[model samples]
Target chain A: MSRLIRGNAVSADDWTELDDATAVPSTAKVIVSLARWRAERETLAAATAIGVRVDNSADIQTLWPELRDLPLVALEFPKSGDGRAFSQARLLREHCGYQGEIRAIGDVQRDHLQAMQRCGFDAFVPRDDQDLDDCLRALHEFDLAYQRAARDDLPLVWRLRRQA
Target chain B: MYRYDEYDQKLVDERVAQFRDQTRRFLAGQLGEDEFRALRLRNGLYIQRFAPMLRIAIPYGLLSAAQMRMLAHIARKYDKGYGHFTTRQNIQFNWPKLPEVPDLLADLATVQMHAIQTSGNCIRNITADHLAGVANDELVDPRPYCELTRQWSSFHPEFNWLPRKFKFAFSASLNDRAATRVHDIGVHLVKNDAGELGYTIYVGGGLGRMPMLGHKIREFLPEVDLFSYLEAILRIYNLQGRRDNIHRARIKVLVKALGPEKFIELVEAEWAQIKDSYLKLLPQDIERMKGRFDVPAYVDETAADDGSYTAKLAADSKFAAWAKRNLRAHVRPGYAAVFVSLKANGVAPGDVTDAQMDALADLAEQYSFSELRATHDQNLVLADVARKDMYALWQRLSELGLATPNIGLLTDLICCPGLDFCSLANAGSIGVAQDIFDRFEDFDYQHDIGEIKLKMSGCMNGCGHHTVGHIGILGVDKSGEEWYQVTLGGSAENDAALGDRTGPSFSRADIAPAIEKIIQVYLEQRDGAEESFLHTYRRVGMGPFKARLYAKVSAETEVAA
Candidate 1:
């Protein structure tokens, strides 16, 4: 069983990812690939607790408008160096206004947590080799950041000015 | 020149603590080698050919005297008694133990300097004109904007892990001293038709295996929209740049593939969405940032030229020659900017000893208002030297062996740390530079050659900026033997252009002599002494030089068309 760090705690993942061939459960919380969700849109839409797993290269504009009612969106990293997901995550939160859980999956490690969190990822599925505790601690490595991002709309300069 | 605030201090302090822990874990065998490599690279630590090299960012080439003393202290105490100032205005220590780098970084943090994003796939140290606030021809100082960009790009969450390393250079001078056109994002501070200050942004220019000039994306981006516009460009690059191939991963490749028009359209669309976001710069923000770079207290009552200065110039030919070559026109009356040449013969281009660093610190305090700037040519500039003290400074510099009197000559070439220290070099560049220095030992002959930029790179990586050199040299390996390829007519000026290949490569022994042949052709073909090698090469094309270089056609197999 895989565990994910959700809201600063290592929690057992209740959601199951469904492949294209897997039969959709009638009432279970399930995640489906973008392709599967597109192919069986009507069937997946009617089900309770449905989520979509978007690949790093997928066009988020095509999926965001319809994802208004979804509770989860799993973004893929493929590998840690391929960082298209960071932009995708920001676009979903800042531009598309998707407030549901944006979970980072695939190649998610301790080092990637801080940056991922800043880009609006509230949930993370740690890599199998990494300890969940270590990944959680990595999120707090730096107490502050320099830029404005999805997590904080005001940059450090503006915040400091306000306090002054 | 921007001092760190409490927030800035906290970020760097936390970063040091984090890296220290990361180092401890790596040393304890808890962290994987590949994973640690990525982490260490973001902090500008690299396992090089000999030892771990640490590059410290000197933001926009500006350094205070106290910070310089700390650098000298690091050089003396850490590994060696010397450091190399790079073309991007950063200092690299070529021999530091991996375990000791954390301590070195801690030492740097005390002085408000860090190695953050100096070498990873992120926005690097934002560079600006070395003559930023001092040059007379500039429309406005670009350092404040550079500082803002530096802060914004540092630890940027969404853009840090890009497909390739990004670089930014800012220039406001009439002369493109910062080499903005060859950077990932080049910002030129310009005034619009209504006399309102703005930026002309250039996108996708770089100098690696495939060299390309940046395309002008925005002719006039208003001052308030700087960060928003920059963020839009960076976001597009982060998401869309090719990640599968390392060589073709730079933003230049993406911009080219999409075409400038299409790329501009995408950036404009993205900018339209984020124009009024929090990333937008407020007027007060710009004013506050500018306050940090406030002009130094310059002496207002000094004479334009004293009798003693004129007498000294008339008396000493050597002092006159040095002054002619090294002095730049300062905007402040009675003050002249002095370039301390690091390209002295028999020395590596930018390597300064610990003793020299300390002495230069003393000189900066005594002569130039306690500030120094690292130039793109790998030299140092005392930006506010008084005119009356010129002779005295020259005499002192002469004693220190810094009076090389060859600022723009052939001997003053840009050579990368090739096979000597770099792990990626195909051939050794320092030895070739030494050979050329030996050949052009005559100061008068070098003066005749005029302003010819001779830049060399060890490989196709182009860290030496070979593509923009007027006489560019690229080292290639031929069956385990070192060979050199030559290019002519490259310039990194306002009208930047990639150098054309002269012909087939030359052997290690033949490289210097081949350069002699090229210079010989230039001397014979030039209109007069007033016409520089670059101008003559441009006017006549590469035909005469190529004809001379490949005259022994039987010896060479492939000839450039």
Candidate 2:
């Protein structure tokens, strides 16, 4: 179950898992990643998107146009604590206007979905081991913000001070 | 003190959201640990040995009593019951959870404060002479320029990504209490024969591994060109500072590599282009900023008020002693600057309790202009208290156990929190400080011994700034045991110099006795009480003190030799 919790309001879990054995059509879509690829461009290019483990922030610009055109771009979280990707995500949206589904995959905890949402992570592929229902509750950590992100069209602080 | 304008507020508010997003992504696996550590450190957060620690910024060490109370409340709710003030005069909370940081920042925001640039490779909190407006010796208040530097340096486009942390300290008077010589940039506010408020800028000074005093490149940079001159120096350093090794990343290293003559030439080259830029001072804006610091009005008083104070002074011998030592004369006729000792017996040198913070705020409101200043020597000050009110204020402060009457005496020591809080320290400085304080509790006896500057650093990194103390003690590790090293004749003034090493290290138990021996030697050989401990040591040298330290009757007679 995977339902969105917007702001402080929590919604019930509603996402269903699709089993690999049950999936049938050739046109069926599934999230593929860098780790899942067995070979080079011959096989890896068949996936929806390619996730590069960015150490420094310079890599996003190098791979921008391909990622911009990809139908599904699942950004890999190599570890649970690295933050270079947030800047990368911002560059994709603000600088590149990346409109593809920016899915957060790997080590995705329930407590992190809301922030991932704000940083333009529209979808998430939760780790297969964690309970899916618990991950959705991670969204409503805070209902307010002082800055704008990809989630909101206007920076809240600008709005407040402009009115002031 | 300059209050935060709308621009500063918006910057911090946005930065908070930025940190929140960074924290979120790191948790969800979009970001990694090492990268987040750097980002979190930029926001002044560190995961300590026990829990997360937060270092809060006290801009130029100027905070109102009300602001101090807000810090006190934060300590009570989000951290342990107390906070440690560093040599740079910032406060550090030993216990804070990573999850509550946003809330903690919000709490600080209510008090017009945040932990911006307290750490990381960015321009740090600007510092100035703690006795800024009230000190009689000062020609001009350094607070306005410090505030200007604070705003200019914050979120600097290029300097934010400097190789290592940067610190800038300013001094406007003869007595350089700001430790200006040992900062990244030490600005000495000076006046030419014409009485213009110019600055003598010293660049590339720092104290970590290779402690170097800054070299002056510009002698009388007028007030209008101060910003341009500073910006020139920063830009050069940002471009040339070594990035290969973190230890070699400071501006000192850059300046050292370039040498002083080359450094000055490079700075001048950069400044020539920006001398007329918008960053250069506008006279009206300077006036606008300066207007924020107008002195409080004082009423005329006669010697009759002085007579009553004299009677109170006569009635309480203790009060007389405290008034003589702890009180400083102000430039105004009926005003005095009050010294509040943070170094009480058994407590850490700079630890202030929540109760004390509240009391200080009350005292500031009732007496001074609701203002307080944190000195570099780990003392808080009420800047403009009336002379007539001094006796009553002293009595009230005495009730709070703060009228120590040991300012600049043997007990007026600077100490670090060392092993008790800092993970990088070699020894427990607070414990040694307590032991020394208990040993020298008799104020009269301490006063009789004369002014001795006893400084302790937990480690060689010099956050405790032991290198510039009159009697400097550096905690060292030898064979897994904590030992203390002694240095003699250091001073932070017009003739500023680093102390010379005394001898081999002493064990934890031997530290106090070692200090005692040095003082004992000073007492035995001083020319007079007028010659303070530092002067006597400078005249006599460390040889006499070293002889007295190791000449002790060792209880080992060939048992090991």
Candidate whose lDDT is highest: 1
What is the per-residue lDDT of model 1 for residues B1-561, given as tens digits with 9 covering 90 to 100? 678888888899999999999999889998889889988999999999989999999999999888899999999999689999998999999888988888999999998999999988988999999988999999988998898899889988888889999999999989999889999999999999999999999999899898999999999999999989998999899989998899999999999999999999999998998999888777888888887774688877356456677788889999989988989999988888999999998899999999889989999899888899998889999999888888888888888888899998898899899999999999999999999999999999998888889999999999889999999999999999999999999999986999999878999999999999999999999999999888898899998998888878645545543
TM-score of chain B of each: 0.98, 0.96
Clashes of each: 0, 8
lDDT of 2 at B432: 86
Pairs with backbone N, CA or C atoms under 3 Å apart (clashes), candidate 2: A2-A15, A77-B29, A81-B32, A82-B31, A82-B32, A82-B33, A83-B31, A83-B32
The per-model DockQ list reads 0.76, 0.04
lDDT, residue B142, model 2:
88
* Ten-residue region with minimum lDDT total, candidate 2 chain B: B552-561
Interface RMSD of each: 1.2, 9.3
DockQ of predicted candidate 1? 0.76
State the lDDT of candidate 2 residue by residue for B490-561, as single tens digits.
877677888888877888998888888887898898997788888888898877887788776333534545
Q: Please tell me which predicted candidate would have the highest DockQ against the true structure.
A: 1
Angstrom error of the Cα, residue B422, model 2: value is: 0.9
Give per-residue lDDT, candidate 1, residue B110.
Answer: 95
